[model samples]
Target: MKSPENLLKSFFAERIKGLVQSDIRRMSRECERLGGINLGQGICDQPVPDSVKEAAKSAIDRDRSIYSKFEGIDPLRERIAAKMADYNGIRCDPDREVVVTVGSTGGFVAACLAFVEPGDEVILFSPFYGYHRNILSLCEATLRFVTLHPPNWSFDPADLERSFTEKTAAVIINTPSNPCGKVFSRQELILIASLCQKHGALAITDEIYEYILYGEHRHVSIGSLPGMEERTITLSGFSKTYNMTGWRLGYAVGAAPLMEKIGLLNDLLYICAPTPLQHAVMAAFDLPPSYYDQLCADYARKLEMTCAACDEAGIRPLLPQGAYYLLADISGLGLSDDKEAANFLLGRAGVASVPGTSFYADPEDGRQQVRLCFAKQDGDLEEACRRLRGIRTARP
Candidate 1:
């Protein structure tokens, strides 16, 4: 008669049992309990556009709440296809190459299921969005890590070349990256594209932070590169761009054959994305280019404000080029461990942040860093900054 915990452990697979829950959520909960401001999660702390909301209401009123096609509602897919061509520079047939997903998270997982065979190798640049690593593990793919060193978070070409092998199946690229906010330059993308082509491998990119650029930094999709479109599966969503994280609307664009498999897997996993929300996302496509321009400008101001707060708090930060995250080096605080520094910040300064350890495959890689998200409302950013300033005087 084993205990219930032991019984559950016995029944669970190693992949499930071995999974380490990231400290981000735990710290988020602690922040809520202490009434502290949470800068840990990279969620936009703003209201979604009214037009998108009204569209959802309209659809529901019109009895469009029923199940949509597994690939997604037709109009939404058509819009996404047009968007891919216009923005990403990838020409895709909506009916054949687009598959709507629950979110980019769903798209990534579906792509993994569609392509990854057991024991196949998947390359991931470290300090990656943590979810991507977990999905690869579930697919039983062996991970090959190429670390993006900090300061610039750039990779050495030779180091990258050595990471691929005969078993290489795919590489996950998250440009406008998380935790560090390093936008992959076009030259870098070309370097990666060359390797993937040489290895006969695929590139599955997570471009969720695609539109959140800062000054002089432009996003270039690798899929748009010559000969790369057929080899790349682009996963992105409306979460960051339109403050629609809760809408759970995302899509995948790839070759027709790959998208067909992804659609079948979506059917098996989720059946379809939320029906009315799909209609709502279609409204987002109508927003003028000025809406995007203002979005970048607003976030740039927030980035500067937060960086100033970090300086006042004695946290040396790497200024971001695209996404709204700041990775502050915590070594100056005389703390060798990020988890300790994060807990101290939350407890003493009432500002919650994610330990950089949550982003890396090896805890040692991020032991002296902490990540704070700046995608907050104006008042929230001000409060968070005010609270963080107290760190300068607080006893370690």
Candidate 2:
């Protein structure tokens, strides 16, 4: 075999280079090995639903293992299109309007490669998902983001407007967002949609957690607004809602012209998502609405447990509106660097959490915050609370 150095390629793509293995997974594995509770990544530690697993089994049993069609089989595409129109009121032609991807992450990568060429400007919000920047960077887009409004972890339309310029190619908006878990209210969506329209920029949304919303926080698709459907690439997947991260199945909907290019990237990069997973996703969409209702209620319970634990421990969290993550300020702990503080917790206290800096383009903006995922089981949450309380009391 050739030497490892010779086997490697040159300094890789800038975006891919900036992307790194998540520290959340690293810390969580250590916790698991040490017999500790882990609330690190948003991946659900629960088993995949029997129904979807059955679908996968059925596909394999029938020997339907050929490479799926370039745009995915008609049933999957039709299911996605109808579901989009039903839930978000955005009607799209199934054949020409959707692309099935390996996961929402893959869909975003394909979207960026298709629409955002080298040097194109892509905007996102701070405390956003790390992969958003990873995908943008992979496509060589100049990254821009608006910092979250303090304490509430909400957005200011003015800050969003200021970020826009002629060089802008697209804006990525996530509701029921990661880190903060703040769902963008309809008014927020309207303002963002207006700005995108005013500037003629594409709006690429990561709506993977749309179904886990709580109380009054409705998950609004930017494309649902008048005239916005044509310019928006709406992304979603079964990873979170169906607890199928390993399934690696997601789909995106947009105008035919935009989707055609995304399809090309999907063909070359992924060769269509795994066939059995696509079959499983079709099963996921057909499940009863009660499945979603129960999932949301379950997520709300976990959210409450985490917030109450934080309050009991004297840490302030700006109440998360939805999603499975919550952000906490670490300045009260007398630590200037949240990353350092997180490392300290990992090494000393056994609480694995993601330092917010890794998610933002400007590390300084996320310096004071850390994100904790609450998607673990109830016992895991209880154990984590006990350990965190011990750490908080012992810190000098």
lDDT of 1 at 147: 91
Model 2 spans with C-alpha error above 4 angstroms: 1-22, 29-35
Q: RMSD of model 1, in Å?
A: 1.0
Error (Å) of candidate 1 at residue 383 is: 0.5
Candidate 1 to truth, TM:
0.98
Total clashes in model 2, counting residue pairs 3 or more apart in sequence or in different chains: 2
Per lDDT, the best of the predicted structures is: 1
> Each prediction's TM-score against the native?
0.98, 0.92
As a whole number from 0 to 100, the lDDT of residue 326 in candidate 1 is 90
Error of 2 at 160 (Å): 1.8
What is the C-alpha lDDT profile of model 2 across 1-396, one tens digit per residue?
Answer: 857775574546434655667767666687677665566677687678888889889988887788998778889999999899888788999999988998998899888888887887778888778778766777788888888775666777778989999888999998878878778888888888888888889999989999988787788888999879889999988889888888888889999999999999899998989986777668887789899899999988888888777666556666787888888777677876877777766666677777777766588877877778888878878788777777767676
List model 1 lDDT by residue over 1-396, tens digit each.
999999888998877865876788888999999999999988786888899989989999988888899999888999999999999999999999999999999999999998999899999998888889888988899998999887888998898899989899999999899878989999999999999999999999999999999889899999999889889999999999999888888999999999999999999999999998998889999999999999999999999989888888888988777888999988888876899899999999899999988888787899999999999999999999988877889956
lDDT of 2: 0.82
Instruction: Kindly report which residue stretches of model 1 are placed more than 4 angstroms away from their true locations once superposed.
Output: none
